[model samples]
Every structure is written in C-alpha cells, then in structure tokens.
Target chain A: MASPHANPSPRASRSNRATTVHLRLRKEIVSGHYPQGSALAEPVLAEHFHTSRAPVREALIALEREGLVSFEKTGRTRVRTIEAKDIREIMEARAALESMAAGLANRNWTAADTALIARNIDAQANVQSLAELSRLDIDLHHHVMLRSGNTRLLQLWEPLRWQYEAYLVEIFKRQAKEDYRPETDTIPSHRKLLKALSSGTPAEATQVMMEHVLFNMTWAN
Target chain B: MASPHANPSPRASRSNRATTVHLRLRKEIVSGHYPQGSALAEPVLAEHFHTSRAPVREALIALEREGLVSFEKTGRTRVRTIEAKDIREIMEARAALESMAAGLANRNWTAADTALIARNIDAQANVQSLAELSRLDIDLHHHVMLRSGNTRLLQLWEPLRWQYEAYLVEIFKRQAKEDYRPETDTIPSHRKLLKALSSGTPAEATQVMMEHVLFNMTWAN
Candidate 1:
C-alpha cells in the first residue's frame, strides 16, 4: 500500500519537510522577495516545493503563527505589513527578551559559552555585507538565549525571529537609501555588554543588554 | 443560501466569534479544567459551542499559536505540558516583557492611568482567592501595557497569558500542599514599583520593575 502523506520518506519525519518549506518561505518574506502584503499562493508554493498542497498549507500556517504572514477569511494569505508602530514595538519586545536572556546567560555562563559568543562578536566587527551583519546580530542574541540554559526562554523567542530579520533589513535599507556611511561605534556597546556579562552579576548584564538592544531605536534617524 | 462559517450570523463577524470562543477556551485551559497534555477534540468542542467545526478549529489554532496547545501530525491537538524548565523560562520571559512594559508605561503615564493602576493594586491587597489574585495580577500588567500606547507590545504579551496563570496556580498549589501561611511583605515591592513608576524618570521605573519582577525567584522558600 502507498503512503497517504503528500511526500513520504522512510527515514524523514513529516515535520522536517514542512519546516524546510516554512524556513524557505520565511527567508523569502524576510529578505523582501515576497514583499509586505504580497499574496502567497498555496498552489505556487506547492509546485515550487515539488510537493502536494498539504505541506505548503502547513508551511503557510506556521509562518502565519510567527507573524510573518496573515490569512484572509477566504483562506488566501499574504506577508505581514510592517508599520512604524510595529518597528517600535518590536524593538521594545527585543529589549525585554534579550535583556532577560542576557541575565540568564550571566547566571549560567560557561567558559566555552563566553568564548563562543566572543568569537561571534569578533566576527561581527568584520562582516562583509549588511545581510551578514544582520545574521551576526541574530547569532549573538541567539547564542545568549542558548547559553541561558533556559529552553523555554529560547522557545518564547522563536516566534520573533522573522521580526528581527525584517527589522535589520529595514535598518540597512533606510541607511543605504540615505547614502549614509557605516557606523563603527555600534561595536563598543556590544563590547561593554560582553564586559558586563563577565561581571558575574545578572543585574549588571541585564541592564547593559537592555540598553544595547534599544540603542538602535535611533538608527532610522 | 446560508453562510459557510461556523456562526452564520449576519451581524456577528467570523473573527469575533473566533475570539469569543478563543477567550473562553483559553480561560478554561488556563484555569486547569482542560488539564495539560489532555486531548482537545474538535468535533466535540464544536458541538459544545453550538457551532460547526470551523470556529472550534479556528479557536484551537489560535490557542496553538499562543503555545497553550499543540497539534500533532495525526491531526490531534493536546494541551502543552508545562515542565519545571518551562516555568523558569516563562518567568524570565515575563520579567523581560513586564519590565519593558513598565518603562513604556512610565513614558506614557497619565494621571488617570496612575489612578486606574492604583485601584487595581488596592484591589490586589484584599483578594480572597488565588484565582482572583492571579486575575488581578494579570490585569495590573495588562493595564500597564495598555497605558504604554503600544498595541504591538500588548499583542506580543498576549501569548504568555496562560503561562502566567499556570505559574500562579503552581505557586498556590505548592504552598497549600505545605500548609504555608501567606507572606505579608509581598505588597511592599508592588508599592515600591508604583512609587518608582511615579518617580518621573524612565531609568528609575525600569530598574525597579526589573528588580521587582526577579524578586520572586527566591519566593518558594
């Protein structure tokens, strides 16, 4: 008898396939390929993934849950539109989550974890492109959450991943549009945050992390 | 011809029905009527709600998105099981979000807003049941978020509502099991938080809020 799933592999899990498709779609949306408010057609996605509509639909629903997309009453979906207010709210939310993550990381930091984060920060200072810079920014924050020894905190932070990507893209785009030169002063805050994390006090680390996360609130200006 | 929606009301919006059902179901799940890891059958819930399966499924999806439930690959849904690690993560996330909300509230606080929050705090002083206290606790935090004038912050805070309720219930349950008396000193921190909020400085308010939130980490003793 044949399997009932849209795409079935003996060794692969059903969710992994859906996740792969979801990540691809999320990347497209975050990278601005499927610009804000653009319709995401199910059949087209299914064809692109070389699968049935079931997995495509599942991917869309996952993205919808993450605030990267929205569905209409008629079951049609579109990328979520980012507004000025959303940008502010996203920053505020990041400040809270990342600051908390930093405190937890301080409480649970291992020598290896500190070295890993320091390496990311060092690489961050020499990133080649805006996209790489954006990825390193995410990497540093994600590493903090991972080192926090709190899996739930990381899970709570998962939904906002696309928002982080969207925000970074917006920042780089705005700066480029204004023909502004790259700012080198941003790394000092990260360096200070690293110093605070090594301070062995949760309060100190959290305070610096909160301020650093919110520091870019003035970036658009 | 009849409408295809679960509640085919000419006046009631489909989304409104979903919201109503969602809120009720969330309350039930949070209050422990629908225990963690319990299966949520869609058809039965639809019949209970006196509607088609559409709205019940929609409500379930919304709950799932909120992390209150999870859907399996077999098309079955179950309440998420809260683990010890999850509790810690949830508390950390709450501290971050609420502290940020407090800072935002300080920036946007009005005389009327202060009056409203004060009333909630006053009510908190005399709450008769753990359930009521939990509700009031949520209400106070929610009011702060509302006063922040950031709708996105409120939306971001919504998914963690059930976790807050669960944490409160766990605290109360553990205390009861130990036949412990209530602590009278807890109110002082809240009072201090209120004073800090009214201190007219964002840094002062944010610092107090962060400390006040993390104060409970040692409360179980």
Candidate 2:
C-alpha cells in the first residue's frame, strides 16, 4: 500500500514489521525509557516486539542514522548520550526551521489557525505542571508548522522533534521544580507570536519565532 | 549492521533488498528516466529488478511518502507530475534549509570545508552540459550543508534535495538551450556566497545563500 501518512512521522521503516519496531525503539530512546548509552540488544528488542531480529536490527540502524543511537567499535549499538553540544546544535537547527515555518504561517494563516492557537494559549494560561506546559508548547508550535502549509518543513521537523522534546522536558524538570508562572513565560511570548502570525508581516513572524526558539526560556516554556 | 553511511541518503529501507530496489527507483523517477505520471506496475517492476513484488511494493510505498509518487483512489501508483506549485514550494523549502546551513557553515567552517566547496565552484565554472551544471550545483550545496556541522540539518536536507534537483534540471533544460555564461550566473553568485561562507558573519552567510537560492537565476545555476 502507498503510504498515506502525511504527518511528522519518521521516514524510516516503511515495511510493516520494521516501522512498528522503529517507532517503538525511537520513542523509548527519545523519551528516556532507554537511558543514554545503554546497549540495545537486538535479541532483547526482538523478544520485546515479538518479532525476529531482522526488523529490530533495521530499526537500530535507522536510529543510529538519526543520531539517537550509535554503533560503538565494540559492535554494540547504544543510545547516544545527549550532551550539551548535541543540545546546542539540535536547538539551533530547530530555531532555523521554526523561524522559516513562522514566516510561512504568517503568509498562509487562516482564522482556523488563529482560533486554534488562541485556544491553546488559553489552555496554557491554566496549565500548572512543567510537563503539561511542554506538551502544550509542542502542540502550539506543531499547529503553526502544519498551518504553514509546507509539508517539506514538517518532514524535516519530524526527527528533530523527538530530540528537542526530550531535552525540553529534561531542561524543564531541572529548571522548574514547581508550577510555572504562566504570566511570565509562555503567555506573553506565545500571544505576541500568535498576533504576529495572524496579522503581522513575514519578517515580524520570523523574528519573533527565531527569538522564541533560539534563546528559548530556560524552563522550556 | 548499523548505518555508517550518512551523506544525505534516504532514511527508508535499512533492510537490504528493499533498500537496493528503493534506491534505483528513486534515482529513475528523480532523473525523469521514468516520465512523470508513469504508472509503476508492481509485477513489471518486480520482474525488471529480478526480485519479487514485495520489495518493489515497499519501494513504491516509500516513494509515495516522499511526494515524488502519488497513489490514486483507483489504487494505481504513478510518479506525481512536478507541477509549478510543487516546484515553488520545493524550491522555497530548499532556500530556507540551505540558508540556515550557510549561517552554520560561516560560524564553524574549517580549511577542509572551504577547500571542498572551492573545488566544487571551480568545477561549476568549467561545466558544459546543463545536466553537468545541475549535478555540480547539488554537489556544491551538499558540501555547504555538510560543512555546516549540523547532522540534523543535513538529514533534513536529504529528502528535499532529490525533489529540488529533479525540478531544477527540468527548469534548466527549458530556460537555456545553449551553454551558460558562468560569469553571468553561477560564477559570481557562488563566488560571493563562498567568500561569505568562508569569512563573513552568520547573518551575511544566510542572506547571501537565501538570495542565491530564492530569486535563483532562470537557469538551474
């Protein structure tokens, strides 16, 4: 069957067994279910997925290509450690991408887009947990990216999203032990961005988005 | 085995047989060896590849996800026509990506990086056929993106590159029937971008790259 999936899913593993395995392993590695530098045994993964080693091996190789997993000289595949350098590069790449996306969104945004983000902001206004805030942030940004009407940008954003989100959640947890002050972080910046995307120029939208993504709040808001 | 091959190859098909089939079909479609809107019959492709229907089906599905091929409601799969809208969106997407790469390259470029792109530019200066020029263009841009020191950026660039290159060749063929004057198009712009990439600020790099990519000459250069 021709792939009907058009969202930000990874391009890896179009074959049935392999895609299922790839998605699961990708999620585990990105979400910290498989801790950094932990070896991924093919046999173990095969057993866990209730499949043979072939698909597991395929998925591991795919993950390695995405920078999430690394193959050591010892021939063991391990989850790559997400160091500070990794975070900087990944974050910068995301900034460039979303900034372009913001410009497109500014050009193509509709009332539906405005309404959607406005509602998301309204939800953010009531959010308490850092984790909840981060999810909302991803949703808002993803909505903008989608409404931008650029499938290519979204495809590029897919792999990076997992790494960005993992780091985002980690940073949020480390920086904010308690509920966020919604007034200071997400509310104003997102509102300003929403307004720019809805009615302002492309330059305005890109500038706001660049700042929001680059020197993003330390708390991941 | 883990994927050590990293230079802009597709994320699809880590499994051996499917990968081989996928690569060949992708090259054919992107090169227009198989004309756009040509039906990709599974049995015929399977026979031609000396493989069963399985790998060909997998490859077709993967191609569908990449937007090079579309599956109709009637269940026939064909190479999607590279329409004007597709070209514009694809080209703009490439501009945004390469512009970001240019900025990163400016900040982190090394001697080897400069040497590589310089050689590519020199080659472009002496290119003859439009086909040769298009390949050179892809080569030069790929070098710049690679030198940007961001693997994620390059990974995002991989899938888009093929589509960009495909339409680029078609556009070039239609626009210029004779040999290009290097001085008028690629030579000056590439030289300017390379110099900026080697020594200028990130903003300068991005600006020059964006112009070179956007209002790109009528030629594919």
Candidate 3:
C-alpha cells in the first residue's frame, strides 16, 4: 500500500489546500511519527501548516475515513493504533488481490512484460537494507498491478499497501540486520510467472500468482 | 456491497457529525443518486444536510480519497465517473477476494455457521421488490465475507461493492419489470455453499463461491 498522504508532485498542482493538509497529516499518522493514539491538536496543526483550523479539521476527518485516524466530538483526533489483527487482515486481502493481478498480468504478459519484471527482480536482488527491499517489493507488485490493467484493483489495494508499508517500516527498524536479505532466487518465480503468462492459460497463471502471493503473506506475517 | 455509510445504529453513535456527513455523501455516490460527473455544490449540500460548509467540504475530500468523488482546485467537486474498464477491474478483484473468502469460510465454518448462512439466504429469498432484493443480496454477501473471518477481505471488498451497487442500481432502474423477478431457485446455491463450508474444505467452498460470484457478474453486466 502506498502512503495515503504521500502527495506526489502532481497532487500539489491539482489539489486544493484541504487536500494538501490531508496528505501531510496522513503521512505522519501512517509513519508512526504521530504515534498510535496520540492526540492531534487542531490549533497546533493549523499553526504548523500555517493554515486555519477548518482545513486541518477537514484533514483529520478525511484521515478518519481512511482508518488512519479517529476523532471524538468535543475531543481530540488521534492516530489509530495498528493491531496484529489489522495486519493479518490486510495481508490476507493483499494475498487475494495481488494473486488476481499476477494472474491477469501473467496471462497478458508479452515478452516486454517479462523483461520488465525480470529487471524489477534484479533490482530487488541488489537492495542492501530491508527499507530498500521493501520499497522495491512495493514497486514490483505495483508494476504487476498496473500491467494487469485493473484500475479498481489498484485503488482497492493502494490503501492497504500504505498501512502495510508503515507496519513493515516499524518491523524493519526493530528486526535484526541479518533478517534484511532479499531472496537471491526470487527472479525464478517471476520468470515462471512470465512463462505461464506466455502460455496463454489464465488458470495456470492464476495458480502461479496465488502461490506468489501466499509466499509474501507468509513472509509479511 | 452493504452501504459503507450504513450507520447501523452502533456506528452512528460512535461517529461525529463530520463522519456522518462523509458517510451520507458516500452513500449517495455509491447508490448512484448523484450521477457520475454531477457537480456537488458546497452551499447546496450544506443547506440540504443542515450542516455547516466545514463538515460538507470535509466530506467531499474524504469521498475523493475513496475514488467516489473528484475535484480540481478552484473548481467544484463532482461525482466520480466509473467506466466499463473500471467495472471490469472491480469485478475481477471481487472474484478473487470473494472466492478466497468462500474458501476461508468453508475451512472455518461450524454447523452453526452453515445454519446461519442458510437463514440469510432464506431471508434474501423473501424480499418482494428489486430494491429490497438488492439490499438482501448485499446482506448475503456481507454475511459470507464476515463469516470468512477476514477483516482485510471485508475492507478491501467493500469499496468495490459500493461501486458495483451503484452500477447495479442503474441497471435495475433501466430494466423492464419482468427482468427484476427474484431468483427463487438461487437459494440452492447458498445451500450448496453452506454444505461445502460445513465440510471444512475451503478449496471446495472457494470454487463454489467463485462460481456464485461469476454467475452474478454475468447477469449484472
């Protein structure tokens, strides 16, 4: 899942000030910089963003809807705590969605698609840290999702990705350095998937993709 | 595809006014009452909802993030239009998730679970109108998803449901009266699914559920 509030370059140009506030606050909440259950003071946020309380209030409400933050009437808004159950549920959902995407991509993949996937895998192989590996992993999955030509799938999957990324970041920071190594032979699976796609059997491709997602689910959990 | 905004009493009390506004607008969009690409006027909505512009504006922003609404800086917000491609992608994703949910529910269900699902299906069969039937259809799916015991699956599957519901409402409204006949025989499929779940073979349940979803997709499209 990408950051709900990452606010890529394009967003700045097209979005209003309220959206900008949403993006920044979303970043903070998902990244754990705000910490779980920590109160978000509207006046303080307004001061920090150099905007009025109205937009900040709006931003908090937006974040609340995304499951990133929560607020009580006449009370403060706070970052929602990430729980194990939440992570497990997210991973399961990812397993379903990504497996489907992989299946579609596999059935549709041309030689060019295979080459692109192979390159992504190679890039993953060179990552030195869990953080870099994590980033590459997201990019690779995104590549497959995009290649599947499933816009709704992309939208559905994106928020979960953002939450999972936050969790992974925390996990990376806490785990031993030796745990960060990328699987050296991961490219074979992508290659296999590509081969299955090239065979033009969506069923076979779906099966391979399912296994791929299950593998990630195991590791992420 | 149960209403994402369905307060259901419990959620209503827990949520603030802003949350309610967000959900009401979301419900409107998902129900297709606000047509795709229709402009949302801030003052008009505020007046209609008997709320201030602040909450209404916040609600629109939240909707934008959910892919149900869109806005440009210095322009009015509009109901987001979903294309055929969007529907296709959503259907594909739904197939994947719901199939997995079926499999999971099958593996996890007790005898009581089977009984409960059977009851839900029976309830669905009792609906008298197309609109009521649609609500029951959504409920049946929701029951299956909840029984699947995957929170992520529910979360991920919901937005797709909302969007699909919007489409279904459009199709339902257009179809001739004869086309709206309730499927009295469809309960058997639910029974079969229950039997599969009771047997604790997730794979079998998954297959059945996939077929069930595909069957609906064929007619729905």
TM-score of chain A of each: 0.87, 0.86, 0.80
* Per-residue accuracy of model 1 over A1-221 as CA lDDT, tens digit each: 25654434433433566668988888888887777788888898888887777667667766777888887875578888877667777777777788888887898887787787788778877767767766777788888878777765676677676776876676566666533223465567777888888765997998898888777755632
lDDT per residue, candidate 2, A77-138, as tens digits?
88877767777777777787788889988989889889989999999878868678778889
Between candidates 2 and 3, the DockQ winner? 3
**What TM-score would each prediction reach against the true structure?**
0.83, 0.78, 0.84
Per-residue lDDT of candidate 1, residues B1-221 (tens digit): 25653444444422555667888988888877776789889888887776766567668767876878887876678988776656666666767777788888898877887787778778877767756765776787778778777765677677776766755665565565533222365566777777777765877787787777666644522
RMSD of every prediction: 3.9, 6.8, 6.4
Q: In model 2, what lDDT does residue A156 have?
A: 70
Off by over 4 Å in 1: A1-20, A41-58, A71-76, A83-85, A170-183, B1-21, B43-47, B50-58, B71-76, B83-85, B170-183
TM-scores computed on chain B for all candidates: 0.85, 0.86, 0.81
Assess the local accuracy of residue B102 in candidate 3 as a C-alpha lDDT between 0 and 100: 83
- How well does candidate 2 match the true structure in TM-score terms? 0.78
DockQ of each two-chain model:
0.36, 0.22, 0.40
Runs of candidate 3 with Cα error greater than 4 angstroms are A1-14, A27-32, A72-75, A184-191, A197-200, B1-15, B26-36, B72-74, B81-85, B123-127, B180-185
lDDT of each residue in B1-221, candidate 3, tens digit only: 25644433443422355578888888877777887788899999988887667668767766776667777654568887776566776678888899889888766677777777677777766767777777767777787788888876887777777777777676665674544545554667667767777774778888887787767766666
Task: Tell me, per candidate, how large a share of the native contacts it keeps.
Answer: 0.38, 0.21, 0.48
